[model samples]
Target: MKSEVALLQYSDASLKPPLSPLFIHNDPSSNIEDHPSLSNLNITQQQEQVQQFLKDDWLPITESRNGNAYYAAFHILNSNIGFQLLMLPPAFLTLGWAWASVCLLSAFVWQLYTIFLLVKLHESVPGIRHSRYLFLAITAFGKRLGKVATLFPVIYLSGGTCVMLIITGGGTMKLLFNTLCENKFNAHSLSGAQWFLVFTCVAILIAQLPNLNSMAAISFIGAVTAISYCTLFWTLSVKKGKASGLSYTTSLSKDHSAVAKITDILNAIGTIVLAFRGHNVLLEIQGTLPSNLKETSKETMRRGVTISYILIAMCIFPLAIIGFWAYGNQIHGGLLTAFPLFHRHQITKFSMGAIYVLIIIHCLSSYQVYAMLVFDNLEIKYTSIKNKRCPRLMRTCFRVLFGGLTLFIAVTFPFLPSLSTLLGGMTLVPITYAYPCFMWLAINKPCAKGVVWWFNFALGCLGLLLAALLVVAAVRTLAITGLKANFFKP
Candidate 1:
């Protein structure tokens, strides 16, 4: 058994393709006999072990049976781009443009590299090529470490994201109601908790949709709204800054203490981490590509990541720069909230209303992108249903129950930004950055002195440290501000 595990590890190292855009159609299994450690094993026995391994870890999806590149791209965009972009401006406010840009760029590159690591690891593991993130962890780190390090983070991150979506969706709804019905209904009367419940019902309805592929149109709409609101927010920020003559300098305020500044910087890092928190779903999206071609999955992920990076570059940088420039220390939790309400022109009011509407649409659609993952994980554990067919009654009950639980959490702690910071800082590190690198090191066992080995090791360590610090900072911030009142408070 030990020898068999070692052989699997050797195959992973020997078979992984170099990082490149071009795909080579070579099978790694053909070279297993070349390993010196496995010389004593007969070819028939070796083949049998490999076959058994494949059977034991069979993935529901396969390379030969997957969706196309376009669908995959849309899925990636939907998963990556969401309400998180709204926080980028505030992150910029914390770190200033120079450091903020550096963090953003570094995060973009690092996330892409970690994603490639996950892809290569998936390719190296036979019978688990189309497996989910949790399976990949089990394949690399064993069941114990997999459960502790990978499974928990993936589950928490997915479920926590759903909670955040509920808060954001409800908050946006409340904002829209106040702005649109300024004269009729009192926004203060309709508590945030109520709005959250309203949005939870909407999410449960949408969550009833069948599968990930069924959400392609929804994802596409989400992607569009994400880009649109980000663009609009930046435009408004720039206009507001110019009218008010706000400074664009990267100077710290005289009133802020050193500790406060440090806290702010950590908060910004946490928010940026959250903004790039889509690596958890990369494999699921990749599974959507057509499996007929040997290079389809690789090419699909590459194209999708490339498009997402392009969108992020266009949206995040400007929003961060202009938002900070406009509001500086005065900036609120979100850029849209910083916009002045009183004495606004009718066109401005209409545009703001439109942006809020887009936010609602975006959040509702994006909610399913994450909720589907939670549902899949839950159904796998609880339901006896097989082959993607659960009884309609069972499925409905699960969705409502899960949705209700998330709604309850959101109502209890309706502090959107603080919760987002905590969730990102607490879970994203392992899910997005650390686990992929650790899995690669475990499976490949690259030369200890080699650059690649040290690079991954460093990234894994850095991710853990960063996550810890961000969690501390976020918790401190939450304690200082106190939780939002459950219902409504003036």
Candidate 2:
């Protein structure tokens, strides 16, 4: 116990975890020395078990733990930045300037604080690593309740993000096909469902690249595309200057009814909440880094997040703030769709085509990072039940099937703008904001109603209540939009 306390004191502050009861005891399977009463045969068996445990990483997200902070940043950017970055402008238009700015900045700070908490909790146990979010929740809330609470939410949060990616990526491809081959493309062009399949095919091909670490190069390109498109779109918008009749007055789907207006605001908040996601996979990225007595992986992840977030700030704020200024309420769908019409005389086919291509590439890379957790979770169960490594080809088949399902959902829906925000409100708010805070409280057990405890409690409660309202708002919005649109249209 003294040694454990000393180790706790020695850990880096950013990685420091409150000493939990779980960390005080050694795993019976791994700590053979603690069981002095074991027979010689039993001792030999325990030794073999330890060897097997060490031979196969308890978590198989990576083949090895040799990744650096740079690779970690790419994973962060790939998952964090996407088509949603473009939505910030519309969210601002929906909420108005002052309220929207405050929400964005506050949400950013709040989620960053929570992510730091997640980083600390990753390796809270001295000889154990909570390399998966579900395991971390189980450790905090105990297995039964934790699984019930977190299992489906994590899958829906992560998987739903992939579904959105498929929608956006496929739509962008269709746009590019139409724009680049404007004269002859419509005759031979595929339907929105077919385009979604094309994107899913690319994603499944990328998923076959073995482990999370193997996607580093693709993540790099994805991250670059994120920055490139953000810069190009915002810069072009600025060059075109502000529109002649720019107004920042917010509206709710052309309805002025009190209920409609309130629902629109709630959905906008959901959009912002969804934008800050990627914390679900935070520990997984850190798991790829080697940890030892002298140093910890949390600090490495902290560095990576700091750098990636700085770049994220660069991309999102300029694009969103300037985009809102340039287009105001005219911003619909995204800057991409609104841009060509708003600046048709000044804009070229090359500019619109370039943005579409970048968006498609970004979606392909981003899908893998978000879907990586889904793949790992599936593998975790397979290995546990089979008591061996999962066969590679079998794993590949599972990914293809998962991709197909999300594609089906993406193509079946008419692709309303409200859907992603609806999903964000339903699943992401708790997974990103509320659950982590509660898990920290469960593990840390800070003084009741004191500063630390109260702070987290307030945030968790806020997330829950906010999610409830957002759901009401999102459902209302979806019903209104669905009534006006056809099924199976993008």
Candidate 3:
């Protein structure tokens, strides 16, 4: 018993976590020869020995921080997918799913190609480092084709601003109408209020008159208005008719399988390619970031592509599935219509609003880029003529003129969607995809390259095929829509 007690005491005193001694003695008077194991060494010596053992055997700990980065990345990805789901109708998900997948793949490849070209363009220009010039080139090219690039910004801004106004305006009118119905205010009844709203719209349009650049502004506005109405044609696909939950279902026609398939291809391609339509802005992002941040931003771009493309696929897939299952061929903007049911909360609303704002800003910024390019090109032309930057007064005058033109479109038609479609589908398509592949082809000869070279060649060919398809689709859509009255209708 005494020996056991002594051993227990010895062990309690000598041992410690992480680096514990072998043993210790409780009794100070115990002879060293009495217990060879316990009396051989003091607690200090045992601890030292234990620590040495640990030091020899222990491996370095490696704590990874990339987990959180990956989490954030996936979160962005899911959100993008959610947006795509909201856009896609369910019908295509069932029958036209295959075609949609093809479009998305094509869109992704095109996006990569487009960005590459923009980078190449940057390298091509010597010492001229303004991004806005790219936008100018688009405008210049479009103008040669009889489309006004500078005039586009005005139209896009007007459509968004006016649509928002109408939404707000309709709400205000509804409130007033309800008040009149209840005899709560002196304002007239529903019909009277309706007339008042029409008059108000007219009055607003008239006030915006002096700012008009031409019929171009009005035409753009009307087109957007038409698109807005068409947008409402798509039905919401909330389960139990609930307004907030997962948007996996859609309301689309079960018929018109072939038409839906074709539409799905076009829509999927449009969203994936157009959603990431800020390669111009990427240059700015890269330029502004610090070296480390820039590298991080490059990673961010990769993450973004993966995230957005995946999200687009997720959203569209389920939508195409459910849309076809339910409403079939009648699926319009099946993705967005479903939003009201799934996104009733303020946070969701705010997030969606922010996305819309980002898209709008992206579109508007694109116009600014075009305008700056035009100004730069014009300045060079002016320099050639008179050997100086265009006079400040003249510059200011042009800015005001352009700014006013934008305002006019903002108020007048405020409804055009055709301009963006044409730009994105035809010119932007080739410039972004075809040019990059060719540039890479020119820069990297195939014989010197093995896998990478052939991969690039394949990518270029894919881009060319997509661009050709875009041109054909765009022309076909335009022709079918008719050119007799005003062919620019959305």
Candidate 4:
């Protein structure tokens, strides 16, 4: 614990967070290498010496992090958008177009600011890098509390995300086959379970491609498919023109009364929040870049974030507007499922099938991005307990187990995706919206009652309030809907 404290930079004694070692000092502008204590060493020696201070060299994210800005941007794009965009249109209708647009843009801007906070704080400790959320959490809170607080959310998020992807990807693949071969292949059609197995098989293969940074090609494909499908969905909807009749009303379970509408709106905020999924993995994304005082990884991270989110905005804003205009409260699910694909006058079956292909591909890469944190945790735990490095065979087995477990859960509980959305309302909000603000205050405690201190305090409180409201709304929804799901229905 003392050695770990020695490795990291610290805040002033007056503002230090509750880490194990109580030593504290103000963080200087330059990195540890530039600190006077280490100025005697040669440049190469200093760089290598700084490397000696990182606590978790055994972690997977720390292995061969040779990725550049473009790769980081690609992974960010892959993580941020997916089938979640499909649900955003409904949020628009529920919030009403004007209010919905405001919420959507506001969430985007808010998340963007929070992610920047995470990036800046990644190397707040000079020679050390937070690299992973667990490390960052521990730095902000102390070891025991941080470890307990962070591990569950990260585990559930990674596992739940992978499961939902399998469900959605497999279902999308099944849809494509049904669309393309409606008149044919009836005698030998694969069931939804088989399609899920197929998706899992492909994901397992992608998972074998070593470290997170090494999967740049796969991430690139995921980013492209996400953008492409989003474009196709919105463009096709706009081509269909507005519905014959429309009203400014929202529907959930076909109920649009005052009470139901309010509940529906609360749930819709969850939907929008989940769409911007980058925060769950942003620190790890930064882990793949090189950081030093000369050219910090935050610069690369911010650039990539700017580029990726600009593209995300272009895809999502138009989609939300057009999707709401076309279907209004009538949209029951995704834009693609609002009506039969083959029967649509403006959309050909071929294009619809292509969109499904993109969805499968995007989900495949998304699984890898989210699952990396779980993989790192598993590997690190093994190394810690055994007091030795995790071998290749054991690492391979970990990937297999992760892929298999998510596959089993996804296949057996197709309805988990719906439930998971509500769960995400409770679980994801703190991690995404609240944690960074609290962390910033703890690590860089500005003058009390000063602008920086009060601003962060207010935002943190706001985030907590929003999370509490979402949790209450989710509970009300579950109480109303009841947990009715058939086993192995998919």
C-alpha TM-scores of all predictions: 0.81, 0.88, 0.45, 0.87
Q: In model 3, where is the ten-residue run with the lowest total lDDT?
A: 56-65
- Give the Å shift of residue 486 in candidate 4: 1.7
| Per-residue lDDT value at 59 in model 4 | 56
The alpha-carbon lDDT assigned to residue 227 of candidate 2 equals 88
lDDT of 1 by residue, 1-490 (tens): 0111223333332221211111112233445654444455798966644543332122222212336666666767777777777667677766777788899888878887898887666556432353467767766787567767776678777787888888888988888887788647683457778888888998899888767777778888888888898888777666544435445554457798987778878887878877777778777676655432234356666776777768867887787767676676666666666664411552465787899899898888878878877776655543222423356677688889999999877876666555767777767876887878888999889998699999989999998888889888888888887866544321
Clashing pairs in 4: none
* Model 1 clash tally, residue pairs: 5
In model 4, where do residues sit more than 4 Å from their true spots?
Answer: 1-58, 248-258, 339-345
**Which candidate tops TM-score?**
2
Writing each residue's lDDT as its tens digit, candidate 3 over 1-490 gives 1111123122222322212221111223334444444346797864443333222111100001122223323322321222223344442443255655565555665575556444444323221221232332332243233124223432232233233333323333443344234456445354423433453344333332221121123323332322332232222332323332333333235564765545544534654454433343333222221112113224444454454445444444444445444444444555444443244442243444433433232223223322332333334344344533356556555544544444444334323334334455544454455545554555434465678677766776775666566555555556666533322121
Query: By summed lDDT, which 10 consecutive residues of candidate 2 come out lowest?
Result: 1-10
**In candidate 1, where is summed lDDT lowest over 10 consecutive residues?**
15-24
Instruction: State candidate 4's TM-score.
Output: 0.87
- Shift of residue 381 alpha carbon in model 1, Å: 1.9
- TM-score-based ranking: 2, 4, 1, 3
Per-residue lDDT of 138 in model 1? 68
Say which prediction, candidate 2 or candidate 3, comes out ahead on TM-score.
2
Would you list the C-alpha lDDT of every candidate in the order shown?
Answer: 0.68, 0.76, 0.37, 0.76
Off by over 4 Å in 3: 1-102, 113-272, 280-331, 334-386, 389-392, 405-416, 419-422, 444-451, 481-490
Of the pair 1 and 4, which is ahead by TM-score? 4
